[model samples]
Target: MNKKPNVAIVGATGMVGHAFLKVLEERNFPVKDIRLLASGRSKGKKIKFCGNDFKVEELVKGSFKDIDIALFSAGAAISKEFAPLAVKAGAVVVDNSSAFRMDPGVPLVVPEVNPKAIQRHKGIIANPNCSTIQMVVVLKPLHDAARIKRIVVSSYQSASGWGKEAVDQLWAETEQIIKSRIQHPGSSIKVDGVKKVLPAQIAFNVIPQIDVFLPNRYTKEEMKMVNETRKIMEDDSIKITATCVRVGVFISHAEAVNIETEKKLTPEEATEILRHSAGVEVIDDISKEKYPLPIDAAGKDASFVGRIRADESVENGLNLWIVSDNLRKGAALNAVQIAELLIK
Candidate 1:
């Protein structure tokens, strides 16, 4: 424990994987060495970490032989296959996937919310879904203060949440739309390029479906919020529902969250509590036309919250507008923070 850990980053070339490297360097996480592991297609690819370049190695069964921490952001399938192997090899895994999130043993975590849960990890710590991560960070303080009973959240997630391909498709389709508008003069263009990354057009519109539809008609992404929030808070009785939408933005995620608490808290009171909450930034100044936005939170670590008000429909309800860089605090930064907590 005295020495710096040898870290292995699985999926080192993907969007979240790339962010992991940036967050590690920015936070100055003590690292004895870094091993960049990716798919065969990415093998021998050079990636920069801590101001130096490192070669990406093809991830194999024995890749975690001497690794201390394996930060996984590869998709669920990859994580399902490799994470257990990494754990078997004595490397603690911080997985960013839906694979093990709900498993009773896997402690789903957002460092700002339930950090003590880190000590309970059997071997793998599941990083909660990006949308869930931001919402829970904002909720932790309020929930603690007023005791949240029910939560309804709608997320305007960015294309970057899907990874590099979705971001590329968004811009590519946007460029095509502008070109078509200019060339054809008053004609609309179909978002053909975006369909591959998302089921519907994402350039000028928002797609309400994220992940596949479940038997309950709620999409998987929505259910992740419902389940992950309960798990992280260690309160299964808390009622929660979510609707996740994919927007054309390239970074950050924005959510409108309404909470019904046991005790009443005014907008001013709610704002004061969030101002002192860890990893939360309040930007509610309507006079200046100020509030949290996706672009405002891009590349930042804090969850930006604003639009604090009371939900008039319910007696003890309060509302919030939460925004954050999904890739940073919502994904990579949270994983790295867990690694930091692990060694401490």
Candidate 2:
């Protein structure tokens, strides 16, 4: 910790990787060195960081030599293969994949919520899922005042959560449909059966399932929200049910979260607490039609909360609408914040 650390960014050409560079620069992270890494196909690619271009190196078994920290945004398979090697080379890893998230020994950290979790890292720290990270940022402050009993959350996730291809396809399909409609007036198009990334058309529709369905009938993404929220909040018994849907949005994710707590808090009281909480921004003014939207949250670090109102059914029921850029605060910014925690 005496000097600036040398950083290595795995999957440096991807969306999350690009966000990591921006967050690091925007936050002015001290960097003695930076190594951009990716697959063989991306080797020799030029990436701009800190006002300079760095060539992308092919990721290899020995890529972590003399590295101080490694930020991983690759898929789970790649993380499962290379993350341990990074750790073995004495670099602390902040992984954005689900590979080690549920590992009891690995700390799942969100710097704003449970920063202490990072101190217990055995070398590899897991970043919570995108949806889970943004939600916990809003829920933690409220949970601290009134212990939450149950949560029912429905997510309107963006295409970027899947990958670059999903985002590209969303726009491509949208344009294709528009052109098709122009060429053939009042004609029905069979577009649902064709897709590059999703099973159905995402241009003018929403997909109910984000990941594969489990035997319990919940999608894997829904279960992730349930499990990751508990682990991040350090609560096991909190009942949570999630329904994740993929919307046609391109950047940020929005969620409708209903909370049941042991104690009551007026809407104004909850709004005040969230306004003062770290990494949270409150914009609940229903009279003005002001609330957190995906477009408003895009490229932002803070989680935006609004639609603050009481659920009249239960004693302490509250409804909140949370939004944050899935790529920034959810993945890359959180990883960068973890690095900041280590250095401080």
> What is candidate 1's lDDT per residue for 78-188, written digit by digit as tens?
999999999999999999988999999888888888998888898899999999998889899998999999999999999999989888888877888777664433443
- Model 2 shows how many backbone clashes? 0
Write candidate 2's Cα lDDT for 280-332 as tens digits: 99988888999989998999989999999999988889999999999999899
lDDT of each: 0.91, 0.92
Over 4 Å off in model 1, which ranges? 182-195
Best by lDDT: 2
Per-residue lDDT value at 149 in model 1: 98
For all predictions, the C-alpha RMSD in Å is: 2.0, 2.3
Steric collisions counted per model? 0, 0
**Candidate 2 global lDDT:** 0.92
